[model samples]
Target chain A: MPYYRCVVPKDSVPYEQRAAVAKAFTDIHCGNTGAPRSFVHVVFDEADDRWATPYFLDGGNRAGRSEEVKAELLSDLMGAFREITGVAEEDFSGRITEGPAKWTMEGGMVLPEPGEETEEWYSHGQAAAGG
Target chain B: MSRVSFNCTMQEGQIGEELRAELAAALQQITQDVLGESPDDVPVTFSDIPSGYGFRGGEPSTTSLVRGSIVGGVTQEVREDFMRRICDSWMEISGCTVDELVVSARDV
Candidate 1:
């Protein structure tokens, strides 16, 4: 399973900032994943403009900070998360797992993916003038 | 018991196959360079995933994972040095940008 599901406002912040947030969030949970960092899934969720706030917290859950400052804050949090967990983004496959789901069926390591990325279209082209 | 871990990410000229072989050779060389004899065999493994994106030079900018195991009682510093050399060689080969590297002690 993915490390954790994230809910954030899309238009509220930029995509880069969003990715950074995802990275940091995954780094924190990487410890639990047991997979280093590469394998940790940082799935993104767009908060509906209707609600106007991400559901992670209550009362506008604004993360208690402004968007401008949130970017840097997210980066710092990622670094701190890495340091605290001692998890590397690329070592997600190096998790230590006990054999045979013993003792509560502990997981979070051994992220075996299914299928592959079949499409990689660089760009789209328009139709020609008059057939 | 003792293991020698290496990563093939961010700038790579060689993949795990090359890395595993290079590591084995490198380990033997290190033993000869530092220790007197090439006492015993070492275990090593490499990871290859096509799901992630690889840089122009073949190194991955997104992220990746690789592993290797070496026998014998080698010091942490020695193991780290070996990993660095492998990482450097990989960078030279694939020219991938590395995110980070780490090692863990696994008792097998």
Candidate 2:
């Protein structure tokens, strides 16, 4: 599970940009890890300041990806942020916490171990592939 | 290392500098005491969400919401206790009710 929270200043990001940013995040995640875009959760929260910090928590599902791939995902994320917010890359700082998915839940159901796809996982892939 | 991140909704000045420091310290200490992570290693970030955002039950709420990640195999009892302590701490600090403080943890 790649749950991302985008924290930005109140009304700093345009409404349409938020959707684009979320979709961009999903695209980067899916392209890198083969996870379905549908399962991606992106929440945009406006803060009382103009600053922004994008935090990512990566479940063990992504541990299989090569380091190169992970680096590219981060690069793409920074680029996407710059594109959407018109902010310099240096102005944005974020953290990604990667941990094992020994206990993960989705759709009110605990997910199976990595590589053991659940029905929701299969459906997410199918929907992403336009099934 | 176990990680805990809190996204709480508070009006400006509701969480002053002193309170913010207290929250950060308490969260880090709790993670250390419960999860065994070093105090310096735990990263606890609090985002003060604006009024219109951060909703619960499909309605905007000025409540404290927490999402925690701990190493696998911690029992439900321990997890619940951790949540209880965390929620109680938030309520005690912010004058929020038990209902307004939401805490959920997942083993990683």
lDDT of 1 at A78: 44
* Predicted candidate 1 versus true structure: per-residue lDDT over A27-68, tens digit per residue: 443333233334343333344523322323111111123344
Error of 1 at A90 (Å): 30
Q: Candidate 1: which stretches are off by over 4 Å? A: A1-131, B1-45, B52-61, B98-108
- Which CAPRI category fits model 2? incorrect
Candidate 1: global Cα-lDDT?
Answer: 0.34
Compared with the true structure, what per-residue lDDT tens digits does model 2 show for residues B1-108?
Answer: 345544443533446657877776776777777767777876666666544433322233344555676666788657666666676676677676544444556664
Candidate 2's displacement at residue B59, Å, is 18
What TM-score goes with each of the models?
Answer: 0.32, 0.51
Cα lDDT tens digits for candidate 1, B1-108 = 333333322223334454456544554454345434442534344544232222211122243333334454766556455445544444444444333222222223
Q: Alpha-carbon error at A124 in model 2, in Å?
A: 5.3
Q: Pick the candidate with the highest TM-score.
A: 2
